[model samples]
Target: MGFDADTGRLDVTPESPAYGTKLRWSAPKLIEAANTTVRGANMRTLNVLSPAPGKAGPATAAAAPDPRPTMPVGPVHTRAPASDGYHQALAAHQATRPERHVDPTIAQAIEAQTHALRELSRRAFPDPDPDSIENTRAKRRRDAKATHAQALRRARAERAQRGSTAAGVQAPSDRRTA
Candidate 1:
């Protein structure tokens, strides 16, 4: 008598006449039957397949509670803007000053220095040809050593003029000096 009529399922009763009927239906038919608007409409159409003879068949047990799978359902995160108030204030302050592009000659000098450093870093550590390559490498090594020594002196003088400390000293160029 206990039936979830909304889902078209009927509980088996000992006194029910159709206890041993063989049940067979496609998914579409079941869906169609469950979707009916009328209450207890066409109840006889549902087949009950169980309990061999005069015995009443036990009703289908209550469906297992649907354990809905967990889902990633949260607001997406966004990164904060990189520029802070201090940067904005500094930028605003600098904006009042006239724009000064790098001098063409100075820019060219920097580019040349960068190219030289790149070339130095690319040079093979050991001379591939002991005679010709060794001579060229020796000259390059001497030139690089002298250039580094001059840069160090210049940096030391600059730091002295500013009364700055050089506790953690670093080279002007990252490439090997020689």
Candidate 2:
């Protein structure tokens, strides 16, 4: 006789009495038998349909108040620290300094040129109303123009303070050839 491990089949010779006999069991009956045996042994068993130990039944447990307390509720606002190194640096940079001497004519000319350029830009790309919601591109262009004009003004002021004239006017060093 030989046994097939994969199929759980036992092969016996034709001469044996139990050679052709097949074995089977009822699943429900087997489960009931196991439960009865476990109950007799006084062992704990979990069955979803049956009442749990220490509880009257499913309905009584459902009707009883929950033992766990409710979670406390409150505002969830968060605040970041007021001061940082970047803010300190910005504050220092924005601090006013003593004014230097700059030619009024040169300053006026620079301001006039900035205004002309701003007008040209406004004509080229007409911006939407300030109150309108969708104006990101227009806003960016305006900001860029303002920043560029401010930079130009600052540069012109610095150059005038250094005794340099407007554009095309050569420096004192450049005036003398080597």
- Give candidate 1 regions above 4 Å deviation: 1-130, 164-178
Clashes of 2: 0
- Report the C-alpha lDDT of model 2 over 1-178, residue by residue, as the tens digit: 4444455333333222232232122334534565587564322221222222363557665777888998759755588656799798877777865567899999999999999999999988776576544577688889999999988887776667466555556555543211
| Positional deviation of residue 93's Cα in model 2 after best superposition, in angstroms | 76
Tell me how far the alpha carbon of residue 75 in candidate 1 is from the true structure, in angstroms, after superposition: 97
What are the TM-scores, per candidate, against the unseen true structure?
Answer: 0.20, 0.21
For candidate 2, the 10 contiguous residues with the lowest summed lDDT are: 43-52
Whole-model lDDT values for every prediction: 0.60, 0.57
Give the Å error, residue 24, model 2. Answer: 24
Model 2 / residue 177 / CA error / Å:
35
Question: Best candidate, lDDT-wise?
Answer: 1
Model 2 clashing residue pairs (backbone)? none
Give residue 84's error in model 2 in angstroms: 76
